[model samples]
Target: MVERRILIIDDEADIREVAQLSLEISNDWEVLTASSGKEGLKMAVAHRPDAILLDVMMPDMDGPTTWENLQQDPTTKDIPVIFLTAKVQAAEQRRYAQLGITAVLTKPFDPLTLADHIVQTLKWV
Candidate 1:
């Protein structure tokens, strides 16, 4: 299988580390991490990963705003974004659907199944 590169944008250091490790080990995906949306954007443009795992809630330039910026930029607009939020609200889920994101996955996820979630969500199988 072709190796996939994923950019993980989250504010928490531990969360980023765990997710990075999980994806790398499970799928052999190249993982890049950023602590905030700003840094994530720059990395997204420079690296142009296969997909992005964005956190919903963040300190500055939250996930939605960052997604918007990504859409605006020609270089990053085509990259698929998957929301990785802790909140599993139906209202937000509907909103996410309307926004045209790839998918939304909740936090506190099983590390073992994280790659499976991505694969199924992206229809990689």
Candidate 2:
């Protein structure tokens, strides 16, 4: 199996920790984390993880804006991103679908199955 490198950007400490542990243990993924979007942007540029799990709601910079910043940069634009969000309303889903992201994974995700969900969503082998 190709070991995936994943970067998780979430404002919540618990969310970041749980996701890092989940990806690391479940899929043997190399997990890097950042607590905010600004830090996440720097990490994304420097580390260049295979994929980024981005939290949709953050104080300084929200996920869509962060994704846009990622897109504008040549170095990180092509990396696939999955948005982790709690806004599951139809309007929110439609808006996310319009963002051209690979997938939208919900918040309060199952720790055990997160790797599987990501693998399935991204078609990672």
Predicted candidate 2 versus true structure: per-residue lDDT over 1-125, tens digit per residue: 78989999999999999999998988888999999999999999999999999999999899999999999999999999999999889898888889888888998999999999999988886
Per-residue lDDT, model 1, residue 73, is 98
- In model 1, which regions exceed 4 Å deviation? none
Residue 94 shift from truth in candidate 1, angstroms: 0.6
For candidate 2, the TM-score is: 0.97
**Estimated TM-score per prediction?**
0.97, 0.97
Model 2 misplaced regions, further than 4 Å: none
Q: Please write out the lDDT profile of model 1 over residues 34-69, one tens digit for every residue.
A: 999999999999999999999999997899999999
